[model samples]
Target: MIWYSHVNEDSLPEIVCSTGYNSVIAVAGSGERLIALLDNANLEQLFVVDTNMSAIELLKLKLVALSELDVEDYLRFIGAEEMSSRERMRCFIKLQNKLESSTIIYWSKNHHFIKKGILYIGQYEQFLSKARPLLKWFLGPSFMKVFNNDYNSFSKFRWKIVKSVFSKKVSYLLLGNKDPAFIGKGVDTSLITNGFQELIDKKEFHKSFMAHLVFLGSLKQMDIEFLPASQNRKILKKIQAKLKNREIKIQFINNDALSFLEDNTSTTFNFNVFLSMSDILSFHKTDYVIKCIKALKVSNKCKCAFVFRSYLRNHIDTDIIKKITALGYKIKDVSNMESTKMYKVHLVEKL
Candidate 1:
């Protein structure tokens, strides 16, 4: 199944989906997080495998529903056409199945912009206490653009000297992609601190602490450390639904790669690439690697790409690099220009 939804409004679950699995195990319609990684790695089929038909049914329902829409209509259906504080909170709460408790508490309790949510959704007031500041007028134009969630069109952002970097279009696109090259990918970014708690970036998140640092003072109140990852009620609901359906397979051992072996079973795969990150790392076992490599190599359809990471201080041994390079994969250096944004991924796939 295939779908196209807006950057933030889309309903997609993340997972560690693998390619060259020897079969069309499954495809997940809500596999938003996995799709970018899977697409980057270039896999062929996602058969939608899951022990729980409930999960498959849910994603299938979403995909079927979305397949009928272009991006704009879906945006409006999710309340993106107008960024009402009420609508925002409503939509966010609707996603509670995919969110966490911490995020719900954080949004309702600490996110100052969310008090209107309490006003809008009478359902959550008892769960919350404090109210957001009356600063809707104070949030600058740049903040409005973000509030609008006009996340694309980075090519036109021209206010280099005056606007906050968050106001730039590039930051928006990179933010949506979750690619770490953007400053918004890390500690200061919402997706990290907001998406998953354990994954929150600790170094540079733009919290009250960062705000305090900018304005030096002889004596002032300050919140030094970043906030812990908050659970979102929306994500939890969605996750619960997805887990109930059972399409994603995340067991570690059951999943790997090398080349000498071949599968003679009659099969056809519309593969464009086979990606790998661990190439004879000794940790990934040369034999499994060879099997994976051979499966892709034998396929008449795809090529491969291999991406790996190294310590900042270490250079790969030229010989080892060359030997892997001999497998016909090219190497490219990744630059983390957006320290705040985050999509830390590496792969070896059909080039």
Candidate 2:
């Protein structure tokens, strides 16, 4: 059980606290942020939810792994503003070992599906080779930098949108076009609708729910690419070790947005906050919005909130807006366009 994922120390807690609800139903990205927030805030409980079973297993692995590192290492590895070279290498080795092991295990169990993806891409071999220039233009040096452990540079390359497209192809080749939560038909779309603006206004259900997207990951490509990089292997392991320590029970669900909002009995889960990263606008189903409203009714917590933002226009569902306002929830508009590039974060809570 290893969620071979890394989280930016700074952003994790902010999103966890965004809803202003002390308790929450959250999407666990690598469960890295969820775990870190738990440790830092010492919040009694967090329901880590996702559709990806691999994500669930991986988060469990990371939670177990983090305990191995001391608090200073956790701060340096997971919380530091920057890492010195010696510290970086020290962390690198720790992260790498777990990645190598997990990658091997992943391929081992899912080999056939993985191989199928490899064959599909062989048809587009030439396209892929030419793709590098375009990819390099966007993903930038960080895509290559992390793999090479170019510690000299500080900024990360773009979210690796360019690289991610290719990586999906690679993942498709081996994993058969779907991992735990991500798939076609809008299963877990981190990209499909990211920058789409006009489309947001078109959703029929928006009148009833204040819909928005979360764009959950920071440097989207880093977890997939860098964690598996030869140079990054060690750092990946250290990151894994840090996660292992937390002893959190994290689960990956791999369902759609609506399915995500429900409990086993079909009630909207009773939690304080719901977090989404950019998939709000991508939802083609109305049940998802209904679930949110239902969840609000069930919440014992005074303030229930859903936080959303996006890489495109932060689509606010006009109907949902009216409904929440009627329910006495105040919405705060926060912008991070410079940092997140078209990103907007909203904080909503019941007065």
Candidate 3:
């Protein structure tokens, strides 16, 4: 099952990798960030890796759609606009030839997800969709203000009320502890008891599509525009053209990233230029992540950049910071620049 149908992380890869990198290694969360990078960065190779096979399939489907469909049609096909199952299937037919045999079979078997719009098909997304009404009922008119982005009237008392309802108790009652949403996609519970708390606290609900999805259950046109790669037509078209012309190559690998790095120590490809972890750090302990980082075979001369995010603050503490610095990298906290205030983003560059 798809854990994340939409990526919550912002265009961090595009930002850090824009310093003239020819290739990128990214965790394929929902394919959105990869699309954003493709649109914004000039790259020759992109390695999209994910442990989830479904996530890889979603990325493949998106790539085929970009190669085949126009901006509007692509949007509709992916469930941005209202389109019937039959119409969606028709659109899928156009993309079928471009997809792998396995990907084609996967989508054909799970056509229900496509009919509902691939964008909202994730397990976590569906949980949010189902929970939206209850959230509205619990918060009353204050819920509407989240969508409207009107925080001036949202009082501290109301914030307390909001916090109570969105507490770990209620979330566990609604969605089991195993659910990706409740677990913060593999993060420790204490690290992020309530995923929406950060955005609400930061008063950044208006600027984040993730905030809209968590609070409103659906997206507005403005939210879509604010999203990383959804509505950037000219860039998308340019990327689409380049994709069709075979200028860029994207490969999807379905394997644990740490394992992939550790086992493939002899691989010739150098991941030294750019690596966008995309919150995958939360899945494994800091030491394990360090082991994986150590396993990476990078170019000695080329300056490398590593990007990662954590939900809570000071996740990479003094010891970890010292460890990373010893590895010849300087870490910068660019959390303020992230569109979604839900994460503390770290941009690490080789010194």
Per lDDT, the best of the predicted structures is: 3
Please give, for residues 159-253, the per-residue lDDT of candidate 3 as tens digits: 56656655544565465334533455344444332445666666666766766666666565454456566446766788888889988888878
Candidate 3 local Cα displacement, residue 13, angstroms: 5.5
* Cα RMSD, each candidate: 15.4, 11.9, 2.9
The candidate that wins on TM-score is: 3
Among all windows of 10 consecutive residues in model 1, the one with the lowest summed lDDT is: 123-132
C-alpha displacement of 238 in model 2, angstroms?
15
What TM-score would every model get versus the actual structure?
0.31, 0.48, 0.88
Those runs of model 3 whose alpha carbons end farther than 4 Å from true positions after fitting are 152-158, 184-203, 223-225, 268-272, 312-314
User: Per-residue lDDT of 1-351 in model 2, one digit per residue for the tens?
Assistant: 222244312232244454344455566554544553443233324566665556555454344335555544543443222345456445535655555465446535743322222111222222333443555565455534433334334243344343245334253334333323233343323333242222233321111111111121123233333221111344445444434554334344556434555445445445555454323433333234435554445445444665554322225566656666776677665543112223445556657
lDDT of 3 at 301: 67
How well does candidate 1 score on lDDT at residue 46?
39
How many angstroms is residue 24 displaced in model 2 relative to the true structure, after the best TM-score fit? 2.8
**Count of residue pairs whose backbone atoms collide, per candidate:** 75, 56, 0
